[model samples]
Target: MIEMTRVSSPSDIIGIRDLQALNLKQNITAEEAIDQGFLTAAFTIEYLQEMNVASPSIIAKVGDKVVGYALVATKEIRNGHDLIEGLFDAIDKSAYKGKLLKDVNYVVVGQLCVAKEYRGQDLVQKLYGHFKDCLSKEYTYLITDIAQANTRSLKAHKKRGFQIINELVYGEVKWDIVLWDWNLTD
Candidate 1:
């Protein structure tokens, strides 16, 4: 049976490992999915471990086999306030200024991946549902950015009701920084 669980505690190491392995094989390390200028799949394992203990995140599994994972940043960066300020300044000064940024309690989607064997099983869609359920209480909404060339993720996110609120250009690549306002009041 498949289950969605809040990833909290060291015992969840196995699930994180499984997610990392799946991500390495299909998304980052795979030639067809090489995403340069972004964190590699290898980093996802540590990211999950950190997020599981540090923030609101979820891990999906089937009998100890991790099939998918999602991360939400419901809290502010503890000591990275300066970094956030700099990022916002750069963004505001850029062409995408005067944009709306509401219910943006989450800063990033550290990682969201499914095992290759589990692809096309609607696991990702289910994971999105679970993630929304988990975060809607403590957080207003979630936000994430994707490379414009990443068509699969962009399509999936759009289908999930995320709108492209702003576009960012970094180095030689352009990113579509989207926002999904989960808070109806906002």
Candidate 2:
């Protein structure tokens, strides 16, 4: 059985490897981690510091072994591509019924991953369930961005009721970024 749990520290190094593994499994480039020799190792130390002090990062484990992780944060965007900026504008317009996002609360899902062996079993939904149970009480909105080419993740999120609200591009990498939202109010 799979289990979801909160991360206690950013320096909780075991999770760093799990996150790296998940990234690799999903075919996401871990260039930043790979190019910087000891940087990946040091990132664990820093991650612990960040999570220990920050309010939104969480990690998943199954029986003492870390298998997946996620991070959620609340913030506003002031600048970005046209589609991105427009999406926020749309969110702001709807969030307030023509008001602003200043009064609304949003939970941004920064990262989410599952073990390869566990992928097709709906573990992703369980992870989101855990996130929703824990975070829904505090925030009314959840948002995440997926690489446009990542059809698997796109389908997964869609199955969970998330809607595609916008699309944008990440500079040099030329990756297509698709924004999705889940309204927890209902």
Supply every candidate's count of residue pairs whose N, Cα or C atoms clash at under 3 angstroms: 0, 3
Candidate 2 deviant stretches above 4 angstroms? 9-13, 21-48, 76-103, 172-186
lDDT of 1 by residue, 85-105 (tens): 333433333332254444234
- Poorest lDDT segment (10 consecutive residues) of candidate 2: 33-42
Report how far residue 72 has shifted in candidate 2, in Å.
2.0
Tell me how far the alpha carbon of residue 1 in candidate 1 is from the true structure, in angstroms, after superposition.
2.0
Model 2 lDDT at residue 1: 55
Stretches of candidate 1 exceeding 4 Å from the true structure: 21-31, 34-47, 75-104, 184-186
lDDT, candidate 1, equals: 0.59
**Candidate 2, 125-178: lDDT as tens digits:** 777777787877677667666655466677777787777654445432222223
The lDDT values for all models are 0.59, 0.53
Q: Candidate 2, after superposition: displacement of residue 83 in Å? A: 16
